[model samples]
Target chain A: MTPSHTAESARRSAGDPPPAELRSRLLGALEGLLAHRAFDAVSVIDIIRAAGVSKASFYFYFASKQAVLAELVRQAVRRGHEAADPWVSPDAAGPSDPVEGLRQGVTDGARLWRENAGVLKAIVESWGSDDGLRALWLDQMNSFTDAAVTRIEADPEALRHLGGVDVQATAAGLTWLGERLYYLAAAGVPPFDDQTVLIDTLTNAWTATLYGRRAADGRPAGGAIVDGHEGR
Target chain B: MTPSHTAESARRSAGDPPPAELRSRLLGALEGLLAHRAFDAVSVIDIIRAAGVSKASFYFYFASKQAVLAELVRQAVRRGHEAADPWVSPDAAGPSDPVEGLRQGVTDGARLWRENAGVLKAIVESWGSDDGLRALWLDQMNSFTDAAVTRIEADPEALRHLGGVDVQATAAGLTWLGERLYYLAAAGVPPFDDQTVLIDTLTNAWTATLYGRRAADGRPAGGAIVDGHEGR
Candidate 1:
């Protein structure tokens, strides 16, 4: 398995299988269950039955359904981090172009939302009432915020356009912006439900925020070469 | 009371008071309780006790706790509509600047969130699991998106800067962007929790989305006469 897929394996307990084993099965089962029913409606028996595991095996891994939720969130966040790697990488600053990096990252991020919409929706819904989930959610978002801040600060071109804007707050707000848009799209809310529109709108928002306005051709005015074409 | 304040009164049952009455009191009580506890933690008995009303009175006004939540969401949305009036007003197109209108509207929006954070948070958190709330929430959000679309389409100066951007999708994404940031600020999530930062970031994002890039003075380039100062 790729390193990103095995990243969750490090969290496994001493007795768990060496690879992503029963614990992953349990987590995957919960994710599958969320596709059709509300988290509150899904019980331990349902989860184990879906995974073809016993009640004892379920409890042996997750203390509760919420525990599985927390792990699913962690796993989702890891994948999110990997997807955004292009934006945060040093290579994004040079010939690679940060705006293009943003386009790639956002497209991948949208796909991530599409793939794990149910797990993400359930966890987000519960974060308000669950302290552990709330804290973990914020922490995961901050990682994205931090990555954005790093990218923005490192780019003089972007900074020149940002002017006196508060980088930290801007980054965090944009991070929350993406989270909310993705959530709305995943929930099949109108306007945002169209995946192509979601991706384009986000790319334009980020570009306009970082540069100034987009050119008539829909590229940021004077920042980067997009898909091998220079800005007008 | 102003027309905005009495907007919810029209929804009162025939038996309720002529003006803002016991139903409003129940909503106010629930809003108050949410400040200290999660919606799931606040029971009907707790709501009645907090409102100084009887169980019969509570059930007479609201079918269930979830019903109360739906009403609270409706009331909050009405107030939100009032808060965003400046952005959608025809005056926003002429002598009054749209960007400044945006500033005033965003400032009012952030304050609305601060005042109704707990209530709004509870409803938003529950929307995923509750079909009634999910529909109500979407309908409410669409109202804001409509306002944004109206404003964007009405302003030729703003359009000149927009180029080929999808007005409907762009406006919807920006609307969701503001909602998410305001929620984070109200929830006391970092960076966004700083009220000043939250308002500024939102204002900037809106300006950027509508006009391309903000100038060094933080006004949208070549668009509006912001606060009596023309863009350089």
Candidate 2:
């Protein structure tokens, strides 16, 4: 029924019917409700009244208020995933250093935060209380961490040069930093012009700090190579 | 007044009823509510019911749910400040050395987090939904940042070895890192076992990264100058 609720129609039974426009209107109204009032304060009565949809329609799409919140969290995460553009995976690379995978991960991570800040905020805001949403967050961030670790460990040459880098810890630390910075940037932290600057600064610092390497003269140097293969 | 509400009688009217017990109950109830539910989900009724206090008692202590949350944030901040053990202010010192100030700040910072993790989490969780809370977080975090900047600028001699440490940016960066790590540690981030470890690791890495030096390969290094004056 509504443009925003496109997926709702797809889930309806073959014989069942609700106009797409009404579905979209309901979704948009929910968004407006949440933006203006605390989610808990919003009632089903309030929702249907605002959407101009029947209570029957409300039940058709959602099981309960909690279900709506759950759906919101899911939509937020899905949007985050869609907005992402992490580093090219090591498996997909061609003659490139595997660590560039991490670099790409950092770049893509920053981009996702910038593009989907609202969605990200909704997810993180839910993290403290919503177990399912929290799990989703841990899964997504840990996946990135896992990918970084795999990239580091898979490259023998790169792993070899990491004499001091704690592969596991560093990966976890970077992922945590990215998640936190994502929130900060979404909240408009200064000196971070946009996600690009935030990503560059974080990746640069992370590369330098984790590797225990000094830049040539204090500025982040160009693509740092690991044993002349994977650039860390 | 619930027990917790009494803690802030100093901020309220002198003629206000001595609702000490009620204040405590309210604060304790708030703490429980925060632990169990998201900020937006926790309602005035929930807090009052949790405290086993009358609705009128709840209002007697707090103007609104937001008021309860605001007071909670303030109490948490005060607790954190009180938890700052051995944090010798630079002005409290015989002399000013930014490194010494920074070292103390780092140590104090870690100790504060280690001691008051729940408070830290409550404050952090409140940031996104509450503009006032976000401003408070930035101000509190930036105070630490400003301290680092002052120390860095004052103790220029201490940083002689660092050819180009970009004091201001480095201080801001380290402050951000410190606050970020505090949250991470509260959330059970591993490898950062205790306050000392976090303080030492973060302080060293911050200085090392800023000065283009390598972060040393050691833990638990809160050496002399914990007094802000070595060889005094």
Candidate 3:
């Protein structure tokens, strides 16, 4: 078969043709570039070249390079939310344990980041003092954490087992920690990617802060899903 | 007095003005434009105009706009380290308690961030992946903590008052918590800037996590300084 024929067959087998949306393609390109380059080093020309789209197409979708980055950030946050979707609201009910939900959030966060190391790393590590970017990132983060807060709020009784924890602060802290953790992994830092250490460190740190004296041994046992559990 | 005369007088009174450093002057100009404009929106022209330097001069000092930013980040990190210097190696052989030393570290960290918000925000919020920047930031943080850790190690007995807390992990957590706290403040989110709240939340939060309970019910209880005493 010709190369075109082989390409068509590969695409056909995949169920759907590749994304035609300029936005998706651009985001993909941006994500790909970020894996190896910091935000400051990459130029608009680089992004357009990597996207394999003309400058006109890129401008049609985004006003500037920064705009593409903003969208990239939004996409990463969205994926992070999707990661946590499985554990609490969808999987269990009635005083559902947040422990599993949290673990899934961390795991999914790690997975999405591993997949899109380029984009997430660039955005998280390259904060600027400009008010616009600051407002945009904070709003995006607030929205992501708000969804998590709403889920927990939906079943107030679900968190009742959490006792006297500052639910709002706890949720916020966990979300930030998850983001920072992913950033660390994307930066090629090991030990953080040590699934066992990650889960253990995160679980112990957060649970102890939330439950207090309950996780002192650095391990929460009994329905624990503790450190020894497979990270996958 | 002529405008030049006043400027000269101001310089003279400020101390024999040192000869202007070329790179620093360019970096300052770059930062001024950046502080007012989004990172992507600011261009070589704006930077040169703001600095009153030719494009050639700008290029001579820095390779790219991003390099200007990287330099600014280094400067900010340096300042942050200076802000925390007072507590890094305190005169006290060690605190009467280990928690106090951690407390000093966090408090010093908050002050440093507050003192240097602009560049700190830039370094912390990059949209592109920057291993170099992350490594720079991590190095600055580790330097500060390593100083504190040395002090703590000097008196293991003082650190031991915690009932066997993991000294190294505890130190890392303290540094991380401080960085995270200041990040919220630097975000320019209102209510989060309340200096008292910043100090109180970080100090109490660090105290609780390390010692199993916040020093004063999450409220500052007459810290040594009058202003940083309570976050409420």
Q: Provide chain B TM-scores across all predictions.
A: 0.78, 0.67, 0.70
Residue-by-residue lDDT tens digits, candidate 1, B5-98: 4434433455545553667778878888999888889999999887767788888888998899888878887887876775577674433766
All candidates: TM-score: 0.81, 0.66, 0.69
| Cα distance off (Å), candidate 2, residue B24 | 5.8
Model 3, residue B161: displacement in angstroms? Answer: 9.3
Candidate 3: segments with Cα more than 4 A from true spot: A1-52, A61-76, A86-104, A126-136, A147-167, A190-193, A214-232, B1-83, B90-104, B126-135, B151-170, B217-232
Residue A199 alpha-carbon offset, candidate 3, angstroms? 3.0
What's the lDDT for residue B139 in model 3?
A: 76
Candidate 2 chain B lDDT trough over 10 residues, lowest sum: B223-232
Which interface RMSD values do the candidates have, in the order shown? Answer: 7.5, 10.3, 8.3
After aligning candidate 1 to the native by TM-score, how far in Å is the CA of A175 from where it should be? 1.3
- Candidates sorted on TM-score, descending: 1, 3, 2
Cα lDDT tens digits, model 3, B1-232, are 1233322232234443344444665687766665555565778888777655677877777787777788787777777667656555656464655566666666677666765566666666642335565577777667755765665566544354434344554455456656666878766553346555566556555555554454443344554433211111
- Best-fitting candidate, scored by TM-score: 1
- Candidate with the larger TM-score of 2 and 3: 3
Off by over 4 Å in 1: A1-22, A52-57, A92-97, A215-232, B1-25, B52-57, B92-95, B215-232
Model 1 lDDT per residue over A1-232, tens place: 3454343443445865666487888888899999988787899999987886778878888888888999998988898887778668767453365666677777788988888888888877788777888888888888888888888888888888887777777777778778888887887776678766677678778888888755223332333324544343
Best by DockQ: 1
